[model samples]
Target: MFDISMAEWSQNAPARARLLLVGGLVALTGVLALVFSLREPGSIAIAEWWPAASAAVAAALCARKHERPYVAVGVVLLVFLGLLSGGRSLELSFLDSVGNAVEAWLVAAIIAARRQQLSLKTVADVGRLLVATVAGAAVAALCVATGAHLVGLDFAASFVPIAAAHALTIVCIVPLVIIPRLHFRVSTPPKTIAISGALVLSVLAAFYPGSPAPLTFLPVPILAWAALSQSMFTAVFQLIGVLGGISALTIFGGGPFAYVTGAVPGIAFLQLYSFTLAALALLIGAAAQERRVIERERLALASLVRGAFERGPNGFAVLQEAASNWFELIEINAAAPALVPDSFEHSAGQWRLQRASRLHEIISRLSAGTEQTFEWSAAPGAASTAQLTITVGHQPNGSRTVVLAITDLAPMREAQRKLEEQLARERAISNELRKLNQQKDDFVASVSHELRTPITSILGYAEDMRENHGVTADEESLEVIERNAMRLLAVVDDVLLISRRNSDTSEPPARRRIAVGRAIDQCVSDLGRFAASKSVEVHVKVAPDTYLYVPESDFARVLSNLVTNAIKFSVPGATVKITADTKGDEVMLEVEDSGRGISREDRDRIFDPFYRSPQAIRDGIPGTGLGLPISRDLVHSMGGSIGLKSVLGEGTCVEVRIPLVRPEATQ
Candidate 1:
């Protein structure tokens, strides 16, 4: 348990302690052995007073694992020298020494195995030690009994004394050695001294030589006094001292134990008395120690709670109920008095008058053991307001007291008012912006419609001039007029579409389950002539069974715009690929082309209405810039998304995903 080794034994501080302990145990064992061996025949031997054995057991219990072998060796050698000095045969001495060492080791092992249970400050630990002591000593006694029988001595007599002595020794000394050491001072030194003196005197008077009186009860009350008033260590020490003295006196033909007819019976009576006294003292001392610990903890917790209450930010006042349903202020924290108005006690101001009436209602709720809260101010235009919370606390004697807490509400109210004003201003600005946006959309829609009619009329008139007027020389001019008119018409149509989509009153186009493969075929067929004119190839790859839930005309317009843009941007002989496939629950459509792609700076805002790329304007590439925006809006209305991936000078791929019509929905 101590994590010690033979190397650490000499180098560590505990090693020195162990050496001193072993020396003391050896010296005590030597003296006791000498006294017992030199005893005269037919005299009391006091075999139940083996203090050295208990001390050896305590040392073994406390020793580190690696240090135990050295301790055991010391014990065996000490016992052997003492037995050999007392004139015992070499073989008998060796056997007896081995038995004692084994007993100490066995008892130590048993107690250490249950170390957590053995605080040695409780009656339960004392009882456990008694059991272990009896078990170990019984085994040692069997060894001694066998040795005596082999040597032609009385085996039964040797066995009883051996067992009784070891058991009694352990019961007396082990607790004193193993209990937690304390540096406690007696509260009343004079009273402690008097009780200690009384105990010593009683032990002497009770065990007087040849007294024929049963005065043994005299020391019982004195022992109890020491156990209850003194520390456990002091009480246990006194117990051992009294028991040792009584045993010594009885062995020398004195005390009530000496009056017994037989030596064995007298030794047994002394053993019983010692064990009873030891158990009583240990139980009382342990109970006292446990109670002291609980009381100290309680006082510490109370102090902490009081400290927090006094230092907290909120104002607090404790009120106790008085006669006739009235209440009186009993206690207050540091902040409480400042929060209370001077007029509240005088009952003069309107605030104080209102509080007086409110206190009556608060007291009623508090008496009913319910918590209540309310706000109050000094007057109608008071600069500050406070909220009071009242809670009931029950006392140990069943009387109820109420605690009132006050909190300032001025900062919270001001924050709420400012937040409301900010929200109102935001709402007004938002409404004005909405109205301006609506007017812009209306103007674009009306102007686009007017321009579309004139543009169509110009294209028709240019066709008639080239065909009917036979203008052979102005043919190129007529063709230019028709081309410009067509481009203007396309721009006007795109603006009209965007405005219609932006209008709140515009209804969504009706949807149908259109075959996506057929739609792609129709879009490519319409773009075939334009692709040929630009010398760009158009590739269509579509799944025949793929269907989409969208308006057919809108889908055609979105596909046409995408294809036309790809053809316009691509170099001559470059391929424009249109592909559509079903993926999961959606239909994926892609239009890819090897073209001069848009730059990253232009791509971000390319979807904005009328936002033509600078490159397109510089290169004379035609685009209304509303193509992607209108495409995105139309796709969104039909529950789809559109995005593009482009690398400048490499190519661009515009991908669109639209929800596929399910068979269950079609049914």
Candidate 2:
């Protein structure tokens, strides 16, 4: 099935116009042939018979190469058909129609093949088109000379005129049709009207009667103006108009070429005139078009670069190198003025007078083609120490410029000053704290010493009274006094030891290897009476051969304090477990009591000096609240750690880990 839509699109306005142009050209050729035959008396002939056909084919071919072959063939066939139908009774033969089609095809093919070469921008391009026209016309003239010979006409005479005529026709017509289609440009209506008027007036003046023979050259200047002021399309159209005017004048024996006596030579001279004018118009017009395109591109690129330079955040400046290694400021963007106060000066001068010596060295390096970047500080007497990052860039023309980025360092300097003041205040407060701490240690040592002498006397007297006398009515009272006196002495000793530990001049504890099992056994034995008074069961689990690298007296005190606290807190019949075990490189001792445990709120403060749990105070447990804290200090001095874990109403556990002694090292 045929698609009617295809036919519809092919017959659109542009397509229809092309068809009309081709058909009209073919009809015009036939009509001009008949008219020329009447002008020549006795024989019917065609003047430049195939010019319109050649132009139609060339126009179609130049539209676009991919469609050229199809368009050229279609137009050529249509023109041939039109010629045959119109010239049936005009002495036009079938061979003539065939020859015209062949000539059109030859010219179109040569032009299409060398289309790029015929850009008319250079003299070479115009020369190539002229050569192609002459070659194609020579081939077609052979057919015309053969036909003239068969008809017994002058073949030699007819060949030159026919060839020249065909060449001239194509030079004037093809560019008019093809250049306009290829390089179409929209021109102002007023400009088009003005150019058209000028063209008409020039053609009339060049060909009008009684004008000098050299006056025909006047149209050459008009054609040159059209090529320069208008597009290639407009220029080619004006050339065709001038050609028409010259041809009409020559045929009437009115123009310079028409003054020749013989018809063929006169027509040949006319053809040459038209060919020369057409070449000039086409070549100049093409060069003008190329120049316009280049100028437009240059302007667009300049605009783009200027916009980028203006909107950039960083300052930019260009300097031109001058005599004696000096520089002249050529250009600077908007941001450059704020960076350098006198940046807008056009004269050559040393703009770096305000810059530092270091900045001058950087500029010297840049002039030697070495790029450099460094921080610069402004000279004194400026508002502030302007810290600037200066970068030096070198150009290819031995010129250099320095770009400065200023940073205000005043806020940073202010913050640093405040920090220094804060540090000084803290140092003063720290010294005062040290002095107070020293005084406090001295007071504690003095008080413990003062209280210790009396406590020792009282303890000695109480021991003597209990040991020398027999059981009496006041025996229990004596026992009570002795027990409390010993406790008070232990408290005093703890205070003295803690004070010594805090003092700078205090001596370190003397470390010795002692059996861990024996130490724990002695602690349990020492706390046996206290456990009996409370009716608490003391359980001892000591790992045999376990030893500790610590002071014997200090270890004994730590064990005694833990065991005493465990027995005091435990209820009657509750077990107080004292376990000593070796764990890796450490000896761990635990004092666990199944007693009223510490509350969560009091656990953190359990080892603090003079701090006791609420349960101990409520139960009237006799304690100075110094046992655990003193034990912690002693353990830490021996390079050990002490910790407590307790659950309310469940039990309390105290664990102490001390570094174990190697028997071999001790030996």
Residue-level lDDT tens digits of model 1 in 509-603:
78788999998888889768678979999988998789888899899989988988999999999999999999999999999999999899988
Candidate 2 error regions (>4 Å): 1-42, 46-51, 59-92, 114-128, 180-202, 262-264, 320-329, 338-667
**Cα lDDT of model 2 by residue, 1-667, tens digit:** 0112111222333856645654555555555433444455455364743455455445444444454455545544554455445433322344444455566666666654744422344445456667777887787677666766676767788788777777777776665444423233536778878887887887777777656755777788877887888776667777777788777766665667667665556666776777778778877877776677677678879889888776765556655445444555555566555444432433354332322334334444454434444333344355544344555566676555655454445567789899999999999999999999999999999999999999889878878887898779768998798788888888888888889988999877788888988888887887777778889988888888888778899889888898888888888899988888889988888899998899888998988899987778888988888889899988877777899899888889999887775344332
lDDT of 1: 0.75
lDDT, model 2: 0.68
When superposed on Cα atoms, how far off is each prediction in RMSD?
9.4, 16.8
Query: Clash number for model 1?
Result: 0
| Poorly placed runs, candidate 1 (over 4 Å) | 1-46, 114-119, 151-153, 183-188, 210-212, 251-253, 315-361, 364-366, 376-537, 540-634, 642-667
Report lDDT per candidate. Answer: 0.75, 0.68
In order of appearance, the predictions have TM-scores of 0.64, 0.47
Backbone clashes in each candidate structure, one number apiece?
A: 0, 0
